[model samples]
Target: MFKTIKNDLPASIVVFFVALPLCLGIALASGAPLFSGLIAGIVGGIVVGAMSGSNIGVSGPAAGLAAIVLVAINSLGYQNFLVAVVLGGIIQLVFGALRLGIIGYFFPSSVIKGMLTGIGIIIILKQIPYFFGMDKNPQGDFAFLQVDGKNTITELLNAINALISGNISVGATVIALIAMAILILWSNVLSKKGKIFQLVQGPLVAVVVGIIFYVVTQGGSMNLESSHLVSVPVPDSFDSFKSQFNFPNFGALGNMEVWITGFTIALVASLETLLCVEATDKLDPHKNVTPTNRELFAQGTGNIVSGMIGGLPITQVIVRSSANIQSGGVSKMSAIIHGFFLLISVIVIPKLLNMIPLSVLAAVLFIVGFKLAKPSTFKSMFSLGWKQWVPFMVTILGIVFVDLLWGIFLGLVVGILIIMIKSYQNSHFLHKEGEDVDDGRIKMTLAEEVTFFNKGAILKELDNIPADSFLELDVTKTRYLDNDIIEILEDFGLKARERNVTVKLISERGIEENPKSYIEFFKREIKRKYPA
Candidate 1:
């Protein structure tokens, strides 16, 4: 882990910057104390990062859970909500133990790519307003319909209006533009020239410059307001800092509502974490595959620690994970160090951190977003043909127009439909041409796996067989034969006699001429394999 400290340290700083506003913003969106979000971020980074198998994946308070947390908090009260969070973590541990992490692999590759692209688009679109200092909504709100009663488009329009009316913050705009410029220059040119440039990342430089700009222009017309800056909870003293931590109400453990809320958090947080794990693995330059069960266990542990000390739910978030990967993080040390940075900074230089402009961070995210959803990605997916392209496009659009989970769900549905269509079309191979047709004989070979989904296609082809013909039903290579298909074959076999169609059933078990019962043949084969 220490082998890549040089890379991990610098990447950790970038992830810290990327995670800071999100921690606060998600807490605000969830209607919890802003400090709670920081607590989750700290625990997610430290505890989860230490335990997680993912080298580049980062965990923190998720925007996807903001709505659920919001409702859960209101219904259960803040203390009770903490209890739910703790319970949720326990549930996640159970999930890990059950080896349910395999669920992540079940998602199609196209849907996963779509998710990454969709999130990329979302990050870009959502940050535009903040980049211009039009902070009408929380920075962490990723939902299409926001808590502010406006959607993504409406917010963009409002930002445009603000820009046109000169209502936007000129300082923020200037800072963001400069920061973006610095990032591009550093990535494209400066970083390549020297080891020093690589050591000192562009995001770190941009943030420092943003802070300097804020300090230099203090009290001037170009000055950014408190809303345009990073807002870390500054503790006046040790006692106040300790007071910020809220303990979960153990008394709420027996409440049915608390259990339900806990289960909900566990389910949602696990799904989001698994999805992010898949996305993060794809994003990792090292091509490392994170152990999903370990990730679940780590997340569950993080949530428990976070909740016990007053924090929102935690999950492996794509935004922070992608930022870590993009920033050159090479190991889990980066994630762990970033958590420490969150811990130490809030304890030490929080006021100084508060001086950094949000727009500069927005600029940082802009680059991250573009990397994830480059135009080349869309073209590549399109070139893969419609089977891959349709689901990918649907996921991207769904994420942009709806929300994260819904978009992936839509993409998965489309992907499954495509799979079914392919399965229907490729259920069987008919050898009807040349000698087979010329001799009034036809050969129908079953696919490797014939399920109920292939019933229609097989039935159609069976019905098309002409009368007084020789029909050879071949299952020699079929690994799995669905009961429904077997029944269809049986019915066809019985009716073929009326059409004077001589039927021959072929399998590895040998051929049956005019078989009386298909079910009995399979039953006999099964008994042969496992005798009583």
Candidate 2:
């Protein structure tokens, strides 16, 4: 997994860029100490990444949970909230131990696709302001509107208004355009010619250009303000760095409200983490399947560590994960490297990081969104038929209009409805090749696996079989038959007897004539076939 340093190294830098602003902004939005967010980012990247099964996923302070954190802080106090975070981590560990991670598998593929597309659109919408040098919303915000009461489209229009009103910073705009140009050139043109371009990525060059532009425009009319850039809390000395870390209050351990808050954090964090795992796996070019249970365990540990030392709860976040993938990350090492970057950069170059313009990072995320929500993706999904398309579109709309979890829930509901309708209509399990034989023979082929869902269909098919029909019930290809379905088939044997129908069970045991029940028939058939 660590073999692709050429790829992972540059990807780490891109994710670092994406993670920096988000960490501080989420911390700000959560009403927590600013340094706490960096702590979460570091723990999420190194601790969680090292333990996680995800190859491309990067964890950190999530924007989705910011509102919850803020409310908890306001109600319970910051120190008390930290105790809840620690308890939340413990709850997550319990969830992992109980193997509750299997819940992630229940979501339909269509819903998951919709989620990715919806998030992509949201990312594009959120970054539009920053792209035009507007700073009303934070960088990684996914909501249609913001805490400031402006919607995505309105904010987008505001960005355009700013552009029209001559509010654009020349330095930021120039660097942003150049950054995107260099990115396109590096990916399409330069990387193909030599190995040098592959080692050093476009985002790094973009950051360098942004820093230079900031220095050059410092005293000019076009100078960008501090608000238009990253803002990690600057520590003056070792004492300052030590002062940043805050421990959870033990006195809050006995509070009932703290337990409730911890449970809320655990539930929300787990859901977000699972969704991100699914989305990140889909985004991966290699299609590596992450161990969902292990991910929960890793995240729980991360939250415990982060909460213990003045940080917000950690979850696998899509924005950072997508940035890592778009930047050519091949393994978890990129995520781990990014954590170190967060740690070292804060200690060494907090001011330098603040110099890099929001527009430049916005350009990087814009590319990520483009890759996720390509028009071709929509076309391909639409081509898969309405059974798939309806749920996918609904999920996208719900996510765009509503929040993430609500949108996914709506899509899942639709997807399940489609499945039920299809299952009801597809009750004909017996595939009859020809009409009938001279002996009044009719063959019914069983599906590969018969489940309880097919019980109604099987009953209907059995109830309508013609009288005196010599039915050859084939289970040769069947693997596992559900108990409910077996009962249905067993009851059908009595019906077959009353109708004077000859039931020949054709299975791995060769054949049986007029068996008593499906269960007895299966037992005899197995005994004869295995013959141990």
Candidate 3:
């Protein structure tokens, strides 16, 4: 762990910047108290991060859960919703205890790729409003438009109006732009020159510059708008910490709606966490495989902590996890440290965090967003074969045009269809062609449980049989010859009449007759062969 610290500490700084805005954004979208996002972030990093066996995967309040949280809060009332959060954690714990983590392994590679690309697009889309200083609606919501009568485009238009009305903060804009530039330069340019600067981390440098720029702009004469700054509810002391904890109404726990909400949260959160873990492992240079069951256990524990402390539920997040890996994180310590940083910062330096301009965070997220939605990523997915590419493309479209889980589900469906199609296409049996040593005499066999897709292969192979001596079909073991294959055999049997070709039927499942019309004969013969 100590050896890991040297690597993870540098990575934590990068993760910290990435996580800060996300925590706030997801919380804002949830319609829960803004502090709840931070709490989830803190607990995710410290509690879950510390407990997690993952070296690079980071956990926090996921945007995927934002919609569920919003609906639950409104329908169940805030207090009752809290009970669901606790129960959801318990359910996740049960999942982990039952060793259900292997479920993550079942997701096809295509579906996972599509999921990653889709999520990247979502992050980019979600951050667009923030980049332009549009805050009329919540942050984490993925719907193009919110129920509050504003959407990504509308909010952009409103932000434009705000700008025209002199609402845009020049200081925030300048600092954000500069921070972005510094980050790009430091990461892409300076870091390549030496190990020291590379180890310093670009996000860390951008954050420092953003802070300095903020301080410098504070002394300037520019009339800056107030909405540009980060907002954190500052707590004065230890006594204030006690007040932050929230309690769930246990009496409401038995409500059917509450249980429904709990199930929703648990299902979505688990899926997102598992997907993120898979994707992050792919991104890791060391290729460390995170123990999924352990991760679920950690997430469950984190959520329980979050609910007890008035925080939102948490999940493994790709953005933070990627940042951790990219920034040189080697173990869970970095994640744990970042969580502690979140917890302590909110308590000890809430005012300082609040001073972090939203635009600056937006600049940071914009970079992260670009990393995710890069054209190279799309190209790479395309090269991985159609089985992978189709699902990958669908997932991207579904996420860009629809929602997260829906996109993944749609992609999975497509992937499964592709698999079934291939399975059907390849369903056939073969026998080596031989007459003793090198004779061209061919023998054909029918596959068990063959489908209609096997029609062409069976027909072509049977049609080419010579009008002479040796042709053998070994269907003795075939339990279920599809109607299609049977039809071919029946038609070939009729053709064999004038052709003088010898035919042999060896079967425990198929028809014994050499029938009349290929299609009609097979229909009758199949029934006669197996009268069940």
Candidate 4:
């Protein structure tokens, strides 16, 4: 891992930058303290990332769980919510131990693709407010309008009006534009020139330029008080840092609300983690498979640790994981080092960090979001056929219009319905035989695995057979014959006797004499001697 430090370090930095705002934003959305996000990030990076089996995936506070977290916290209170988070972690550990991690595998590929594209579109939509300096609403909510002040569409309109009103700062605009330019140039132009440039990612360069631009625009040193800046929480000293730790109220664990919240968190966070792990693996350059069980264990541990320290629960997050992989992270060490950076930076130079500007972070997120919603995503989904495309399109629309879980459920239902319809259609009867049985000779053939649905067709053919004809019924290749079909055959046998037709049972299961009833032949010997 150390041998690739040159590459990994830069990648880690990119992931770190990308992760910073998300942690805060998700925490805010979850109704948790701002510092809670930082704590989750620290634990996810250092603890969960270290324990995780995935090389490229990054674990952190997930936007997917924000709604659940918000509801859980609101009902249970912060202290009780903390206990639930810890309990949720314990439940995840149990899930992993029971080998239930394979649940992630059952999702259809089309649904998964839809999920990725939906999330990408969501990230872009959610971050638009931050990009243009609108911070009234939290970032995770999918509603068109926000509980805070505006809906996504309405807020977007507001942002546009604000832009026209010149509410955006010139300094912020300059830094953001410079960062975006640097990223675009580095990725599209400089990256193709040489191995050296390729090794340095666009996001990393954008970050450096952002900082430099902040300095240049200010004409001096970084200062939160005087310039556009990041807002890292201030912990005055070692004692102050220690004071920040928060413990869950064990006494509240017995409350019904607490348990309900725990179950909710466990379900949502685990699903989100599983989905992200799968998605991130798809994006991994090495095509490495992440151990889903281990990922659950690691996330469980991280959430437990984080909750104990006043942090939000964590999960395998695609945004950070993709950034980590795209930045060239090769191992868990890059993730771990990035966590350490977050931990130390808060204590060492928070004021400097605070000067970094939200616009800079917005620019980075903007790029990440665009990559997810690219036109290629649509083309790929369209190629998968109606069986897949229906569910995929439904899921995307559900997420865009409703919520994530709701969208997934709607898609799943449609997928299941489609499968059932296909099954019903495929179960139809088929016939094969000579044009007709001439000269008082009758012959009929049954298709493989005759079901009750085929009984109707069999009866129709049997009714047509002439009286006083020599009949032959062939079921040689048939593996399974339904009870209803057997009943139909038995009834037909009685009619054949009156018609003077001699019925021949030509089947893999040995034929029986026409002297007995069809029902009797079907159940002959009761469980004793029968045709092989």
- Please, what is the TM-score per model? 0.96, 0.84, 0.82, 0.83
**lDDT per model vs. reference:** 0.90, 0.85, 0.76, 0.75
Q: Candidate 3, which segments miss by more than 4 Å at Cα?
A: 136-138, 153-169, 219-223, 236-240, 427-532
| Cα shift from native, residue 274, model 1 (Å) | 1.1
* Each prediction's RMSD to truth: 2.0, 4.1, 5.7, 5.0
Candidates 2 and 4 compared by lDDT, better number: 2
Q: Is candidate 1 or candidate 4 better by TM-score?
A: 1
What are the per-residue Cα lDDT tens digits for candidate 4 across 105-188?
877777777777777777777766566555533344554435475656776777788889987556666667777788788877
Which candidate number has the best TM-score? 1
Q: Score residue 104 of candidate 1 by CA lDDT.
A: 91
lDDT string, candidate 1, 85-121, tens digits: 9999999999999999999999999999999999988
Residue 247 of model 2 has an lDDT of 92
| CA error at residue 322 for candidate 2, angstroms | 2.6
lDDT tens per residue, model 3, 1-532: 8786767788887788778777877888788888789989998998998889898888989877888898899888888998899889999999999998888887887777777667667667666556555563434566555647565567667777877787665666677778789878987799889878866887777777777677776757642345666777776777876676677888997699988888788878998899888888888889989999998999999888888778898999887887787677888898988888887888788778766667777777777767767899888878877778888899888876667778888988898888677755563564445646444455666656666666666676677666764566676556676766766677677777768666555455454433344346445646766466
Q: Is candidate 2 or candidate 4 better by TM-score?
A: 2
Model 2 agreement with the true structure over 229-342: per-residue lDDT tens digits: 777778889998899999999898899999999999999999889988988898899999999999999999999999999899999998899989888899999999999999
Each prediction's number of clashing residue pairs: 0, 0, 0, 7
User: Model 2: residues >4 Å from true position, as ranges?
Assistant: 1-4, 160-171, 236-241, 286-288, 427-448, 455-532
Query: Where does candidate 2 clash, by residue pair?
Result: none
